[model samples]
Target: MKVQYFAETDTLYIEFQDLKIVETKDLDENTALDLDANGRVCAITVEHASERTDVHRLTVEGIAA
Candidate 1:
């Protein structure tokens, strides 16, 4: 898993897996979900990250695996 924030685009991308994205779905006007061919989530993308989220500060809790 990985989380990346691009200052230039003001976008935040969270990748769940390193898989090929088969389709992209808009969760809202400023958010998008990426899915693999198997319909599993690949990543999440947020636009205007500064306005919607605190990209400057990030905290990760309990591990999934």
Candidate 2:
């Protein structure tokens, strides 16, 4: 998993898989989910991140096989 934040747009993106997203579905004006061609979630996008979400401090813990 990887997390990226764009200070300019104040948007946060979290990628769950390495697959490239083919489509995006907005949950709301400020949040959206990304899916791969197989319809599996590949990533997430959040707009107005500064106000919509906490952009500071992220922790990841897991093992991928």
Candidate 3:
């Protein structure tokens, strides 16, 4: 999994898998979901992320070593 933030576009992208995105579905005007061929969610994209999310703070838990 990976999380990326683009300061120039104020976009936040969270990728749960490295699968090829077959389709993109809009959850709203500023949010979108990326799905693989199997209809599994591959990633999520958020526009105007600065206003919608707290990009300054991030925490990860339950990661297996």
Candidate 4:
């Protein structure tokens, strides 16, 4: 998993899997989810990320095998 934040667009993208997204589904005006061709979630994109999400800090838990 990975998370990316762009200062110019104020967009935050969180990738759940390493798959290429074939479709984007909008959850709302500022939130959208991405899906791969197999129907699994690929990532999530949030617009106006500076205002909508906390871009300054992030937390991750658990151990990667």
RMSD of each: 1.3, 1.7, 0.6, 1.1
For model 3, which pairs clash? Answer: none
Go through the candidates in order and give each one's C-alpha lDDT: 0.97, 0.88, 0.97, 0.92
Q: Give the alpha carbon lDDT tens digit for every residue of 7-54 in model 1.
A: 999999999999999999999999999999999999999999999988
- Candidate 4, residues 1-65, lDDT tens digits: the string is 88999999999999999998899999999999999999999999999999987798888789598
Instruction: List candidate 1 segments past 4 Å from native.
Output: none
- The per-residue C-alpha lDDT of model 3 at residue 39 equals 99
- Model 1, C-alpha of 55: deviation from truth (Å): 1.1
- Residue 49's lDDT in candidate 4: 93
lDDT of 2: 0.88
- Identify the superior model by TM-score, candidate 3 or candidate 4: 3
**Whose TM-score is greatest here?**
3
* Residue-level lDDT for 16 in candidate 2: 89
lDDT of 2 at 17: 97
**Candidate 1: residue 12 lDDT (0-100):** 98
lDDT of 3 at 11: 97
Residue 57, model 1, lDDT: 98
